[model samples]
Target: MSSPPNMSTTTTLQASPTGIRMITPKSTEEDTRLNQVIAQVVSFIQTNLCEVDKLTLNTGLDIEDSPRLIRVLDAYGVRYFYHGSILVIMGACPLNSVINTLVLNILDQRSTILPHELCPYFSSYRAGILCSGTIKGKGVRPQLRIKIPDDSITFHHPGKHTIYDTIMIEVAFSESRGDLHREMLQYFEHYRPAQLAILVKIEEDLSSRTPRTDPGFRDRAAQLLLRFGNDLGKEIHATYLENSAHDTSVRPEPFTDDEILEQIQVEDWIGTIAADVEVWDLMHSEPRLRGSRTRLFPTPDRNSVPYIYAGDMIPLALHDSFPNLNVSQRLAIDTDLLCMRMAALIPRFACWRAINFFSPEDEDEDMDYNADDDEGEE
Candidate 1:
């Protein structure tokens, strides 16, 4: 410094306090190319397709949270479309597989293209549309439906609250050709109203006269029913039995209620359990029911073990329904307890019900709630 350092030396020694580094950003040319490619694909799909209205570019969206994607789509007016596990396109888009292939070809070559992260977005987008109840057309309504057993137990414990009245347990069994459906019917028929509902789904093909047959399948099916179904329901309720075969080619149409009962010898339990739970929960906590209640048994011996029944049907030791309470007063006590139990069960069942059947409105509302919670946390 005393000798007056050269210009080159002074420049080399100069450094900023902010630790800034000089680097070039992506070129305008490259940005133009990428945007052009995206536009081309979107335009091609929209112009040629009959049902497609607009294309959604999920550039920064996280595909894992389907509810978020659905909300975004709803804002943009995307009603219905088919969906897989990933990627969602708007409008009555018919060429879903073809569009997926095209998108993959273009994006797969990129080093940052993560299929795992991207696929679920599209899948959930499609699910959102379906849930919106927009998949209506001609035959069969093009709707998604789950076939539950029309057995007696399901009727009583149709939703989660009833199912979880105590601890819940589930068991699966493989069915045989001619006897898979019949065997389950025979085991559960005796219980009638008291028996658990059996929901049978065909997971594989079980042809009566097929060369490819599973010899152990029938025996295994019978054994499962006898063990779990018979053993568990020895006292409280009848056992539930359901089966599914792999063969879809020769699979018969879903059995009618009467036909299923006649063949399976059980009751029919249908309708949305989630809806029932929501309605029931609201009724239980009503001001009218809460205000008109009085405690008949204020205290019981802590040492006494309460006998828990299948339906949470605990038998009161006192014959008067409410011990030390008069006949006029007993009605209120019984009503209050029944209402409380039902109310408690509704929300529990609603959660379980939502898992199986999600309405579009429900999905949107949930997304809004999550957004609010996230904002609050931040």
Candidate 2:
């Protein structure tokens, strides 16, 4: 028997020129152990436009960006529809690339294994009898005849459905429609699936725990479907309420890090001499202390509140207390005091990501950006 996979090494999918795909482990790990799961995963690669190296990249692979995987899926009987960068498959077919990506990400294991005996599946609607109605030019109107598939596990369909063996995939989205609920009933009555997979996608952010009343419609619809599944003696696998992972609006501005030594040196100096002199004492000793608050602190009023500094503005007051110190020694003491106060205000004035001491918002703006560049890339 071969040894267990080395977790430290990276794992990647490699496609042979002959179209056979294999998992290339960084070490000498065996493929037979994870063949079933790996094959299931390989089947999900959709786009052929991706670079060869991308198959090994750390980023999550999706149908929209992976071009080479796209071509591979086209050959595997999977079809795609694009809405901008986003790609949509016909349905949640088990072997489809999207579903495969979802399952693999959830498992989070490079050598993960899926059940070999998992049921075979497809995306199709129940087709058989056709009922016709007379239009203005048409002569005959006949009653409709619907033919349900003989498979034991089929997905419920309202014209189109994602089917696995005899089971149908049902999805619940954020918005509600009365017509969809009605159609769901009709589909459930016709195709009694032996098992089903219910996928729920909620547009709202799941990170928030704020409670709100859910309109009983979606819950009622789920209940009705679950009841139908139970009556049909089927197994139901329900997924978590999924939200969009790509949100450009959540951008956090990057800030600069403050020098750690400067901050610590300032803090220590202030702690050692905070009680030596007060602000009023410095203002009384120096004529410049009576000037505007803006000149005293130097930073803009919008970004930070101005305050008298012990290092520069209050040097005269420190000199009175430390009469033995020379000019250079007093200057050094003043600098340390200023550093401490500036470090204290860092958290309140700076961006959450960075530790900028007193930088302006304009420092974060990009100067050479173009609208056309963004449009062409999208």
RMSD of each: 27.0, 34.7
Task: Residues 1-378, candidate 1: write the lDDT tens digits.
Answer: 463332122212223366643322223443344344334434433232222323334333223323433444455453433233223343332211222232232223222222233222211011120111222233211222211111111111212222211111111122221222232233223211212111211121223222213344343333323332223222222121234333312322332223322322111111111100000101232211112112212121223212112121111222243232221211101223323443333333223222111111223332333333322111
Q: Scored by CA lDDT, what does every candidate get?
A: 0.25, 0.26
Candidate 1 matches the true fold with a TM-score of: 0.16
Candidate 2's residue-wise lDDT over 74-159, tens digit each? 65453334333333333321111222222222223211221212212222343332212211221111111232221122322223
In model 2, how large is the Cα lDDT of residue 127?
37
The reply for model 2, stretches above 4 Å from the true place, is 1-164, 172-183, 192-197, 205-378
Q: How close is candidate 2 to the true structure, as a TM-score?
A: 0.17
lDDT of 1: 0.25
Q: Residue 170, candidate 2: how far off, in angstroms?
A: 3.1
